[model samples]
Target: MTSRVLIAVTHLLGVGHLARAAALARGLAAAGNEVTLISGGAPAPLVAMDGVRLVQLPPVHIVGTAFSALLGSDGAPAGDTIMEERRRLMMEAVAGLRPDVVITELFPFGRRVLADEFLALAGAARALVPRAAILSSVRDVLVVPSKPGRLEEAHARLLALYDGVLVHGDAAVLPLERSWPVAAEIAPLLHYTGYIDDRPVTPAGEGADGAGEIVVSGGGSAASLPLFRAALGAARSVAGHRWRLLVGRGVPEEAFAALAGEAPAHMTVERARADFPALLARAALSVSQAGYNTVIDIVRARVRAVVVPFEAGRETEQRLRAESLAEAGVWPFAVVPEAGLSAQALAQAVTQTLARPLPPGAAIDRDGVAASVALVACFAQARCRRFPALSRALDEVAAGGGSVALWWRDDDAVAPTPALDRLLSLAAKHALPVAIAAIPAHATQALADRLAGEPLASVLVHGLSHANHAPEGEKKAEFGPHRPLAALCKDAAEGLRRAGETFGAPLLPVFVPPWNRVSDDLAAQLAACGFAGLSAAGKATRPDARRARGLAIAHTHIDPIDWHGGGGLLPLAEIDDRAALAVRARAAAGGEIVLGLLTHHLAQDEATWAFCDDLLAFLLDHPAVVRADARRLFREAGEEEAWCAA
Candidate 1:
């Protein structure tokens, strides 16, 4: 089942938040979801975002490391009008998508600057009838807030609005409590999806591992000037190794040009390259900030490295992550604290990292994309009970060494009406098989031609004329008690002949009477007409109808519409309750059974369409469901003597 997801990301300094969120969006979309990503940061030209619908909001960034002043697109403090506009656009996007999951990047734990917008989005999601899952998407480490009561405030808001917190790092490598003090308070809602790095693991070329080249990268943030200055001095001192310094695009052009001008004969300075990961794979030593994306890339490259934790203002996220990696001994990493960092200290740390042998590998869980998708799927399943019920039924049956069959029967379908076309389209969308019970008398060659175009649409013989002979109509029935046996048998035979002529062999030999009502005499007449199955609405469980006179009986247990009430759809809760009972009945059945779903295309409304979409997706999402036709069901029944005997 493909669900709609809305992910919001606000990156103030670096592209790390937006990049990681984009990775998650790609993962979810690759798993067959319709994803909408709302980003409030400046766009990165090099970062490729595919498979998701992107909504770029008005850009904003922090004023230096203050984290308090918000700068607008013109590089001045954003006025109240700009802030209000951003919030309004953000709210409108959420309301329009009406997504199944609302993922906010670094909210509650970080991104406090945009809390008003995020909280408004969350409130809008809650107000939806079928509310979305409000989730907090945070990185491995959090910048411990220095303000008193800030942790409590974040925790309280999380408890009030968020359903879960997806920590995108392996807890075995660095747990949440190592940096965030209130992790324990939200432990119940915490889920670790490993690290979100989807870079390929192509090993460096033959002689690349021993290249003895030094690689230096400052992350994509304006905060890398100090690191670039120190690295330039270190390049002058490091004698043997060839040095390459990459100033990211986030750094100003003037600073980049200054670093380029100061490059020594033994060094190369340029902008960041797309092959940075490739460079790390071959380098003898790597020096970079302890940003989330970079650290993961370094680990994936498997090179000896030194990290300079960016510690401006109250930002301790990078420093904590760097120290955690060193403490775990995962990589041969030499950490140089940004505070009072000097060129001499950086040069020595680079030398020390180069001298140490690389560890075998880290045991951290790096399956973040897949794990996170699975978790969201489970969360969606839990919220939608129909899926879990259907899943449980399939699992229980499979575990008991039984198989399940499913088929759809659309009653009163004679021609290619718009409603019938929509029903067939829905069936086609899910790859489900649907039997159109066509009234043989009304079945035209045009209808048959239209149906022949659809591979999943099959024809079943509805009763002759579809007219009721039930005296003043106690209820509508084509083969009711008031009808004579001889008349009914003759009509049934004529119906069979008409169906054979109209649909030929493509039409299955199944009889579906109008109003799903049939007599024993009509049942007996089926075999003489060469019918293999009799389908109708029956009890909640299988064998709702029995094998009658050598004809297999398959009844539909699910009908979403309330035909008696102006042809409207039933309440979702009522429909789910009925489905749950059927599932429970199937689980308790002693033998394999086929579950039939009944539908009336002409009588459907919008609510019916929505219900059918969700229900069919849920059923098809399960592995044990085998779409069946009347012929296959009869054949399977013949193969299993138990079905015949029962």
Candidate 2:
């Protein structure tokens, strides 16, 4: 089918995102979809290919996911004019060349300004294009949300607007739950298209003699010179092992030009190269920072190495990423806070890393890529199949008449652009009480003012200041009063009080953390602060699902459209739209038919929103279907049958 595809790319800085978009473009073309690569960040040097087309949008640099109304060359802002120009270019580009499928790179998954363009395109596609597939093609792992206040909620709005959220990370290496929020709800819509970089090579075929001993690397740019130097010094300090350092694109030649000649004979430094995966396949060991790209290379290479997490301000992205890999036993790793790192520490980490056994590089759910691809192909073909993926999702959402309280992260930072309308409407549709967390005083108060009359509107304690977690570690043991916990209890309460007093709406008793990874004392802490409830999800690691056991973390579960790495979106194979066909099959088997839907109010994208409307549209596509909200659902829900032991 000749479907017009608008492939959007918004890497903001790194080239990894554009690289993945280039790869996915390969598949969309093979499947005969008319794919256009919409350029957002630094324009990728064109890779010429037929069927795949490129349309450049004026590029804009994002400071930390928020649109920097200015560009930056050395991490410093350009002029505001640069941002305005990019915005104008994007709108003009979308308005002129209408597409059948507007495939966003990271808007809902990460970049959101594109979402504004997407909504406009979605409307045009729905009206004139008719069969346009609104899709989001994403790499695995979103830099874990670091926004302080409403910025979190602003992101979730992006996810609710898309048709399909295409995840490029293979679940074989990582589960979506390890990193993202509302993973279960987003699981069904997720696709693991494999790590979209470096094809695999067998070590048996390639001689190890030709390759070096161990490979150390930092991804593209933004390399931590201190971290890299420390790692190199550590390797050099060790006497015997052979090592090659892959300096990232971010590193300047001036920084390491002398390292090659000055280095201990055992260590060599080279510019960042693409064949690192090939190097990994033959190496005895590896060392690298935990950029998602680097992590994938090491995993795919299946080499055992020590990871030294980057020590930078609020970089929960690489720190948590490395820790997750370590927890999964992929490597023996260590972290160096940028504030206090040394060459000796790195050298010690390298020495120890060499001794550890290579973890069974994360298990790949073999068919996650195929499953994710199939969902996209089905949409590409515009085939309405049964949603077993959707049905199986509902299987876990126990039918209940209990009061279904809902929770989601919000920063009120992205500015209340019209981007939030559909999501708010959905909450309204369900009569769900929406909770915004981690909001700034003025932002939340303004939000309360804007939402004054809405019965569902309310604010909760999120954070005092919505900055990234202090690098020391912010993940509280479940219920612990940690950084955001205490900050939130103090500030969010004040913000709510100020807003409630001014706007006349009652504030809520929930303490919602920015990322929902609250510490152990948070619940008891919140209760002490007079909080009546707590809401968070995708973390099955927390204790007491029942508030009766502890104030419930959440009653109305959040459905995160897992697009980041294998974190939010499920292994696509697990999703079976065929289960919707099972509705027919369920009738035949005399079984109950229940359909489930979940959303992470954070990290929502254009395709996710479209997919939702499509799913509901599909549900409503036919007559004789009823969509019920959980309000008073426990009363109608069947009770668990118990048998007395005789």
Candidate 3:
């Protein structure tokens, strides 16, 4: 189960992206996987490369915030020749490694200038014999695109090419939706891996180097020159305490020399330290720009701090992270906006931040390295099992010049809950349609509103009220013979009408009985109530007879939950056995059978959810399995014949 993984990362102005990619490579390599990390930016001496195969392309970077102008290592505009060379090197690495998974860091989302190379890498990965699972690696918050159609372009690229996006932060802390506008459309593919922090925890009293000094730093970029100058000016005003300023590596040598010379007697300025986290552990207070790696270090150190986020060039990412974290009150902190930063404002913020009481410990999830590794492994395992026994059976059908159709249905949807969201997310993720049997009496407008964005979901009318009228010692049934024929027919018609009003075009004129049971008398009356189809559990009984009576019947063949065994997931082996039987039955029946997979989201646990996700992925990957859309399956009365004939 050791997968070959290739991670491609390019740092334009800061080294945060490359730093995170390096952490992931180390974690994956430590877990016994063959990991190759390809860097497209200037090499950094601080990033660790232990246990990873490193490939460096001709480095390209941007000066200041001029992202439109790409500069080479020689500080000149990178011409067409250099760009072609970079693409060639990247393609060569991808073709040679033949990795099982390809991870692109912040491409499609941030690096629009390099789309050609990243797109080529994705195409090359897909062209491999066993196509690699392509994923986008991104930070918690992205720089919101202001240009028209930029968001649309990125979203389109993701839907067309990527398998999933690994978000390296917790959703509860800072959900990507707060920054990315189209997050809901791609919610199914987002996997939050917590915050990626590999720094060792320094205990109290362990960092004597910065024991009682006010430590100030900008991340590994020159984006904080103004902040450093303001800090120098603030040192004289904020005064009884000693000040220590750490300049980033991207700062010019002359700039560093000037800052060092201008320092007062109580102030010290130096290059960014390798042991900054240790320094923060014992520092009196931390004052720095709000960047991913910097915030993580501050949070890990449990130090009182003031964050002055870099807001130049309309960059809102740092400001958003700083404000959100301050609002979360995870720890005592202050946010000083960089727009009008000066010595007085920074001095006041720093002094006030020092007066606040420190929290006992951090509340954020910091196991990102392990969590990211596990997520990648899970994705790889799922990909390997994409052609399971059921899929193989369909392959045989395809080899014999035939194909099999499959559809999904979930029952008892009444409202929009977390479980329902998960169910719809799975459908969206696999690009498959799912027919939701909604209890009309309890269905809410909120549920209808939620489905407005999900074009792949359709609704079917469950029995009115979903209430049982059967007598004691009898099986539960809502549309059973216990009620008058007129009453049953009226309820069926009313249910269809209510569902139509709520769901509009997404509503299918189908009747689903409660507990998957309906009396023969009521079944005969469904066509009269304007229902084009009748769906229940197991095989359709007397299908030809039903079609002759102006009704098409489609029944779900497999349910992966153990309803009688404590409502947990049925063993995968048992599910696989049942699926094999279903496929065999479909093949024996002239390949006209549409294999139906049933689920009840309300009753599903984590194990059941995982099984369903895997099942859908398996079905989608098989070349011979055609996913039948519910609308097409039951578009008209007696349409089953036309569908079966095809």
RMSD value for candidate 2:
16.8
Candidates in descending lDDT order: 3, 1, 2
Top candidate (TM-score): 3
| Predicted candidate 1 versus true structure: per-residue lDDT over 1-646, tens digit per residue | 7777899998888788988999999999999998899988877766667898888888898755978788887889878888898888888887788888888998887778788989888877765545677788999998866789888778767755676889998898899888877554368678999999877885876576335688889877778878889988988888789888888778889888888999888788888887888888888788888899999888888888888888888678888887887678666567898986888999998877777766796677789999999877776655543334555666777677776678888888777788988988888777788888999999888889888888888888898889988878488888877778888888888888899899986688788888888877667777787788788776664445346666777778889888776676664546666766676675565555678888888887655675676677656656666777765665444432222211
lDDT string for model 2 (110-215, tens) is: 5554555655555555433233556666655655556564344533443344456777665554555556664444555565566555345545225564264767
Among these predictions, the greatest lDDT belongs to 3
Q: Clashes in candidate 2: how many? A: 82
Candidates 2 and 3: which is better by TM-score? Answer: 3
Q: State how far residue 562 of model 1 sits from its true place (Å).
A: 42
Stretches off by above 4 angstroms in model 3 are: 384-646
Q: Give the TM-score of candidate 3.
A: 0.65
**What would the per-residue lDDT of candidate 3 be over residues 301-391, giving only the tens digit for each residue?**
9888888988888899888987787677665568889887998999999888888788775488778889999988977766534225665
TM-score to true structure, per model: 0.60, 0.55, 0.65
Cα lDDT, all candidates: 0.79, 0.53, 0.82
